[model samples]
Target: MAFEMFPTVNKCESIGREKHTVVADMDGTLLIGRSSFPYFALIAFEAGGVLRLFFYVLASPMAALLYYFISESAGIQVLIFAAMAGMKLSSIESVARAVLPKFYAGDLHPETWRVFSSCGRRCVLTANPRVMVEPFLKEFLGADMILGTEIGSYKGRATGLVCKDGVLVGKKKADALKKAFGEEPPEIGLGDRQTDAPFMALCKEGYIVAQNPEVKAVTSEKLPKPIIFHDGRLVQKPTPLMALLIILWIPIGFPLACLRIAAGSLLPMSMVYHAFWALGVRVKVKGTPPPPVRSNSSGVLFICSHRTLLDPIFLSTALRRPIPAVTYSVSRLSEIISPIKTVRLSRDRATDASMIKKLLQQGDLAICPEGTTCREPFLLRFSALFAELTDELVPVAMVNRMSMFHGTTARGWKGMDPFYFFMNPSPAYEVTFLNKLPKELTCGSGNRSSHDVANYIQRVIAATLSYECTSFTRKDKYRALAGNDGTVVEKKHAHLKANKLMGC
Candidate 1:
């Protein structure tokens, strides 16, 4: 029986026919939200590092032009495949096989897969190259037949050429269906895009699995609601504008940041609040109201969760006090321009400790023991030095969320990260201050090791953010990103990813 939204085709009378088949488009319909083809290159590039990915990413623009001016999306796909030419087919197959299990379990759409499995014969008619999806279609989907574009290969390597059949697109797709299932139309069909319309015309029962209800409203207004399915997944397709949008927010950032620093440093604390709020950075504070940062008191030490380079800046904005900060890697020049006093650590334990002790003696001081900017919720092991220095520990938990630009980074010139963060229309921060650690919790008479005090602070911050507590450290992340060995002679750079294309 056909899904009710679709008209029961005349072919229902022949339901028991040996080839009673249901066909679906691969990219958006049967598979997950995105097209299945281009990911083939990503799989291939796992063996080749950032350079290989960089080369493909560079060619994407020409591919985009071809999409608009010449053929449809098929042209862009061919360009992508062409770049993979000479790549070992085994490399492609290996990554696909390794990840297919997880992809099917996670990324594949749940609702559509059910409708797909309910059909008699599972045939995915797609413009994606057959070899790319064939392994999974056979191993995972139990596909009876695949109508897809074919790639030419020689001696276990891609040749970067589409076979003589050309891209399986538009009218070509409709003709291919007729060639296989005879001149008679299909009994059941499903598709997501207008490009899927040609073959849909041949279906006895056709359904549009639209992501946007408005699209279905305007296009299939007269069509019955149930047959016009909506699984509520965003359609993910390659777009030229993504790279452009990421960068448009960058140009004016530096100037605005200079103004932010100058204003925050010179103006009254209340005006400092207005200055950042004007730039659309809302700082939300919670928990009990603490005592004043500046007082007749001798000294105060602030221990905070490491989020971005601007953690202290955001903290400074929240507390209305520019506490001098001690850091491991930040340069002295960067600190000079900052609104707050910053102590750059020399990475020498004794020297750095002396500097921190002296700074604390002079006035209030702040430090992020995690030692690095971590974009993820999990944190690195906290340095125990902060715990050893002061019993008056002020645990500050801060997090920043941005839509247009991410402010945190592991590499590249992070000096501009705050500017990039402020570039967003509405950059936001959630800051929480736990009650100052009591004598027992703070490395006091119970004679707690600095390690114990550090772990306690880590737990408090992790619980506040609802982030997973992990033993992973900056060294682990550094090795992953830069292939850093124990010695820092010259860390080999990893393969450039799509996200890394825009500066960190």
Candidate 2:
């Protein structure tokens, strides 16, 4: 759906040149509480055809009664509570892990994704415990830093207690942010509750009140502009809403069905395939080459490029068996309902190696590997974490273009851009599954390290796509270049697209 509230930002204008930061509230701001929480419970309950929800439902009343008694009683209640709490943290986590998938799949607001696509550095400031929200954050929300309550750990299990000074809320949140970023921090903040009022007021550009009316009334005068959510959606005008809804919900299934029949196992990735078709972009498969040799019994490591924000969406729609995408610490904040598994990658050495190794052992490991998105042909250098994987690397190339009606730079490529994609008409994009590179090529042939494998992979990407090879180096520098006229170029492209669609 189109979110009209997000105003268009001109990259060529004065405001686009400035660096903007985003401070977003977790929980209700990014998540639809009852909808997501219970859905996860449902998914976990059904995994492996086991009715976990049936058990949880049967246990909830008793659990609730037990919890109630524990909360009220003085002597025996305390002992009972202590006994229940004694259950290992691992047990609770395991239960949560199983139940989370049901609630989280595709529950995120496109506006939030559009916001992330539109801004620069983003931080999540919340009162919720980090462990309770980590998977949602890591998989979809795209938060760079998780500012929340730190829970106690004993013998590697959660002690079911929050650390004394770690709760991130009220003045404490401001203190935590200042401590981490020093006196200066992000310029924009978003939230839906009164508790977030303080943090949102800290933004130089101001704040966006997410969903509640009561919170908005209180913060309206003291904070930056507050954004409110209505009808389970961002409160945007009607015209744009009609436009986006019309485009996204149109009937384009026949072609998708045809493509699926031809592709077989590859058909489930219909979302990716149909998006290009919807834009009338044609894919001329050169020829059906024999499948590449399978790697050492380990598994497949699907290392792909990040061409547009839709790449993963298409992958999720097409690739069967929940393919988890590896992302930076940032994406976790917005990816609340991501349908599959997601692994967080950190720059910290020990953590990075551990994550890479574990991902290789699981099913296919899907990674952008580029670290950042690029519209140009040259790929950003790949992180060395790829070399740690035991599986063979399958290089996937994503091909896309600026549609005539919709002309704008790609989202999340890098930089502090406030680009809202859903507000405008969307362009067409495509993902092509290319040949896989052997472990030797990805690991290094001879003395070449993983960086060499990265180089070879980048080269293959450049050869297969139509992007400008040198454009990757330009980065945000192009926003000021005299010859770079994105608006004019966009209009011309839009006109061309309209003509092509009409055969005029």
Candidate 3:
């Protein structure tokens, strides 16, 4: 094939190419993966839920057969239909923006990136749907233009059909490039397959990306922008085998998850830790927990770095006692199932402060000031309210591991968070209690401002967990994932009372 004759991307000079424009193929050229199945599975699950994913998986064999025997476009069309047919366009876009980038960032080809990133203008040409690939390419990879197959949609729902130009393979890819660049061809073209050869032939220079399983992917740190927040249930990319395993496991896992949750909820606080272990949930506690306080004394405030909705429950498990936690936004179902007390924060500075102070006076309190769960090894900006509420602050670093499924989602129903988390086989939580803040360093002691104290505590927990701290807040997280500020609208009665208080 023509692609076999082209020089490998590794042979292309990647340095001193600021003035050059590079047109690259998406999957194997820019990213390490040669197949697009995992990504389609991701979109399938994220947009249409597990049933859609199962349907996609069932059709995978046909897609594979057609891919190898019939045509590449035929395989892709089958995937698009299985994954996206009848799904809302909005949901697909949200997944593209929030979920796909993290996975895509992880799969970046080091050699391809070296050449692609060196160019002044970058373009990506692929058979993947334009909506699916555009956001990640433009936002993360800084591509100047994207030329890809367009999905047919009616009334905001995908029809699972490609547009008239069809899947951008062979002559279609070359034709699209001609239409995009006019007489001025791109300086460099990178491709991984013979199908990509047509477009690669149009560029001034062409480099083939050969299949090499041993090549290491470009690390997340090397990306143009770090992915701080992402929302999806699947922890790892779902290849055909992985997808099959997941489908097979869900029936067994759900009941197991329900049993585990029941054990944690029904068992006594002291015994919950042992029950969790029996149920295949591992809770590892490190460092000394403060002794129980007297009834009359103000409670010790536990400042925790949030990992999931279960952070406080695990914190309570670590302490062998129930610690009432203040939450920014939690579903009613989550509150109902929670073993420890969960107090909702109103987001009002004075009201929340008073509520937390009252909780502290009642006994020990656990608060995650980051206000949201961050999946990465990073802490969001602390709220500072907890810092001002008490000097008896002990930073808690919380981390969780799930091999099969993530227990959290920004776009999905919040009630399912716990259930999804428990569904993971042998899920684990690590809770490390750091040294208590000295009285002199606290806002209550008049030695530091609220923000200063909060920042100090954030740093302390971050250092303990070996995580980087960022100024990204709950709003930032929601905006990236759900396209809104992470604020739950209050009930009518509560809204009226707040309005009356404000004289609105």
Candidate 4:
């Protein structure tokens, strides 16, 4: 039986293959992150408003149950597509036209797009309905053929029915390719899911693209992603319930946070650390600190990576001592709620560098050179300002782990307090204090500029985590997210009235 032919992946040093039929999967294979349906659904929720947002997320599992008991995996996929019901084709298409380019710019599987572009007879074969995936493929990749579920619609909206053909999944997908091509199986196939194996057999060879090395290993060596870290945060499109929760909790969380900081003034630093545990923080530490320098250790500069506003608080708690922190771009009042001293950055680099030196000479100081919380895995280029201040640089790696409710954010209201972050059921933190960078990295005596020292220290941290070290600075990230080419400062022009125009 055809079921006997499972797909196998073969790894090659390069994807220089030419003139082969490229049949690719849409979700995990071609796109870097989540599948197309969920991503489209997110855009729907954003534009459709709050009630629709809740319905989008909750209705899926319920519909999946209804479909699964009646049919199978195919039914589950149809339910996922059904979430797009009640939208005019024109409306959805307009949203797709805007969001698709931004998504493509920000995320991609390393080799899939380029090879698919160059290959002959490019086809997108997926269980996601052809209508839903069509506009993007037709517009961007010049898709010659697309084989997917057929959606029956009434008036303008999706009918949530798998018209005559049903969901084209697994073996059925291979059958669809045969029926369309009317020849030998395609010359090459690309996919990420195990379900894609049968269709892959239609090709002379295949490449499996996914984050899980073991999954990729079953068919091929894990493919190298183009960017080590792409923008990782989901758009914070809160459903009505989440919005209500935030509104109700703000009244409560905002006040209690103030009291917590006030009480922190009197509490011993040890008491403060455990109190955070009461709010569900589990911290793990690695490496040794240079023998307990008294709370008054001089010229000890801590170079930390940034993830959340709560970073310095977590650090002081982990070290069991207060370390005043310096930052840039935080809201004006963020420091009022902090239990530790926060020196906001000044515009002049020379003056700021002088101020940092004075602070270090008095006691330990911590600074996040990235100047922003990176939701992605990779580290942003560290600022050389700290490297310019002094050479006693100790690199601190900070990661905030949260499954359902993230403690870290790059977007949220200005006044949201740290205690509100602790409201997450349990948030684990990992901290690594690597040995102070060697004298070569210090280079404070002017053998090298601060930029070189900053780059080396960032590499040490990136190496520890097997992360891709990039020179992409915070400004580069903001530009990519906003879809602005470098040098265009997107300030509001006086005539600007409608919000979020032209996707920039």
Candidate 5:
């Protein structure tokens, strides 16, 4: 049968399909993109690093030729080999669980999702390697089963070859469905291309998803579970062209990043702001900043919503003065390079409070009470310790934008964060200072509890930044992304002295 003969997915009834079982193709049917190259590039970059990504980009032309002229399975095999060849199986799984979901969530097809999500049981059939797509499909998309090409592995490492059955395309998809359901086929099947026709024909009803570039992606709020925490260095999807550009930029960007870091570290506090602008790091400060307090007067505490490790540095730049900031899990390199004094915080309440109070006595102090950086527009639970220390709290909302590389990572080295952050073509930071807490609202003068004061400041900062407040804390973030509680244990011979610090 001709592909055009099948009805469009939009024509199918989704309102009362909760009892039905639906089988769908992934690349174009469920996701907005038709080509699987970007996802493959992501895996290569995130799991195998820049070299692997370069290899994958180099192999793309061959994949494309095979895809268009030869066969879908042949093209995907090239991508699989280029991206996953010799990569650790564990590394691939880690990326699939922690990194891919955020990207996948951003590209959901609205029309296809309307039908697929409405069904009680959903299955995804794709030519992409199963190891790279299963976690996101099962966990975030509420998929009941995933029928896809399986990658061959040996001793916990990928062989970069498909399993015996090979890439699930054309007749293979129909056979898999038949094996999975026996004589009873799915109640509905949704597909995007002619190759998907074979499997769609096996369903009780089949609908084709027509190519529509104008269709908007389904919002993250519509997903079964929101992507709250994700890990990776890449800020955007790396298509073949983008990947090549990134590989090309690194030679230039690394030195530029080094210069940016050096200038920030060596230049005087007042001169650093101009130096940052000259080097392509933009700092935009808003709101009226209070004048620097005298050494005798207790320093005003700046409570910032954390976006990155550079929050305090940017805050100090905005104020044009070095403010001693208390930090948690900051790398030794970060501390050494920081222009302003960075005091490591001991999780012990009394000691940290005392240290912060001492710093306040010296001058202004900045602290991220969220205890960790959150990339999304959601504020983690504020640590209430800072609220109790003093009533002179100035809530600051921090925002950062990066195009190429994220300045943060949960599964990689922390020292490279500053370099990665600066590697972007024009990374930008906005620091908005909210009103200081009035004496009446403070724990020192008012009857408010420390928790109440913290919550109030959190709300103030969240409102200023247009972010949502979450009860999720630093531990919650690390547990989700890194499989740990965001805690670091100091070694006997470690450079830093803090016994236990929160991981970034």
Candidate 6:
């Protein structure tokens, strides 16, 4: 059926991927001192419920028994439910309000801090009631809301009855999030117990921090991702591994494995290329809309402006549809470090012609016609690839807000390493799609030359992108406006001045 459902529309579309919360367990989690069992139970007891004090009273023995027979399960989870079952709603709220904070102090997981800083909002989901956990969260973590099992009460006295049918666990926690926040839940979820496994599943993305082997096993096979904890504050990126693999493979197998991987345009090799610049690289997009798959209707040969040592990657990531790219033969060294599929254009006429024919047949080709990256408003001469291809020429103009030194055009930029040009931490690139040229403009009769076609395409692209498009002689058709006083005075103002002087 190909049907898919998510907590929210934003989640369904990936717009809210970065704005979700991590729903985590407290106690053995974010805290390291005395367990919060006594406090949690006291609150539940006051709320008029059966106190399951066996976990608190006999925690060591019980944990030992489980470790020997079954597994070292989440010790905090057992005690929490016991506390809830034993309390009256009113009494538990009072104890929770008073004692939750004292136990919250400790070194929190570094992954949690990253989520807090990066995501839109962060939240805590625990079996403890809001009155007990709310104050600590607000004072320390500044959580948006708490989703926990609620106990009912009346007047000022104890109800002596568990109001909710069941404690929030597994499927119930997912229900709780949906009930509180509606169907569109947060992007991240975090928890410490097997009970929270279902709730974490409801979130679009987040991590599950398994404190012990038992909890890890409980959720291990069930969760979509492999459980990982924060080693420190920043997650260690896998770039170094990729770099090492490529460097090591060069000697072991020589160039054969690298050549095959590159020629096949395998996705894994593409990922390796990305890892090369992982330090400087960051994901960027205009929006997450699927790229246009139709034939190139808006054509001028897409002469994209190049910048950042990873311009090819930027094009691949930013443009919705895949683009054919033209590259210099010397730049092929990148195949060893990162596999990029490109049309190899040679300065030789026969070789260039064959490559151009292949690119035109492929439909969308990203031609860096300028041959090299340059400063804004200045562009270099168009390469002959433009002259050879007879298609709608669309100028794909790029204005680089930042420079990456690890690119093909950068000084000292050998093709061995990956350097990225990010607009910022979040890539905000400007990709202006210039208007396409009409076919008749270049197809006029017998004597039309490739240079003539190249010049015309060049001027249109220059005028469209507002770059100073010049020719081999360095004199553009627009040179008169480019501070050339002799040309401007002689070509433009001479007729006006002569008529005025003669009083005609």
- RMSD value for candidate 6: 24.0
Residues 326-392, candidate 6, lDDT per residue (tens digit)?
7664345565444345666667878776777655665656677666554335445666556555645
Q: Evaluate all candidate structures by whole-model CA lDDT and list the values in order.
A: 0.62, 0.45, 0.88, 0.62, 0.86, 0.45
Give candidate 3 regions above 4 Å deviation. Answer: 482-504
> Candidate 4, residues 1-504: lDDT per residue as tens digits?
132243423342235556667898877776665444355454454335435545565655655565447554555554545456676655554444434433543444555665676676788998776765665566545678888877767897765566776778777888898898887677778887667878887777777765542231111112212222222223342333454444355456545555555545556666876775665557778887654455555567888887778788778878888889998766655676566888878968988988898888778888998776655555666778888777788998887776434444333344453544554445567788999977766766667778778777777777776654445566766654443433212223301311122111
Q: Estimate each model's TM-score.
A: 0.58, 0.36, 0.94, 0.60, 0.94, 0.34
TM-score, cand. 3: 0.94
Residues 1-504 of candidate 3: C-alpha lDDT, one tens digit per residue: 477889999899978899999999999989999999999999998888888999999998999999999998999999999999999999999999878988898889999999999999999999999999998898778899999999999999999999999999888999999999999999999999889999999999999999899999998767775666788889999988999899999999999999998988889999999999988999999999899989989999998888889999999999999999989889999988899989999989999999998888899999888888888877777887777778889988888999998888888998998998999989999999888888889886776898788878877787788876666678878886764523212224323543343222
User: Model 5, range 239-273, lDDT digits (tens) per residue?
Assistant: 77788999999999999999999999999999999
- Give per-residue lDDT, candidate 3, residue 390: 80
Q: Which residue pairs collide, candidate 5?
A: none
lDDT of 4 at 135: 52
Residue-by-residue lDDT tens digits, candidate 1, 401-501: 77655565443356655655666667778878888888988777567888778888887887788864554456655653432322211111211221132
TM-score of 6: 0.34
Error of 2 at 108 (Å): 41
Cα lDDT for residue 37, candidate 1: 28
The ten-residue window of minimal lDDT in model 5 covers 495-504
Better of 1 and 3 by lDDT: 3
Which 10-residue span in candidate 4 carries the lowest summed lDDT?
494-503
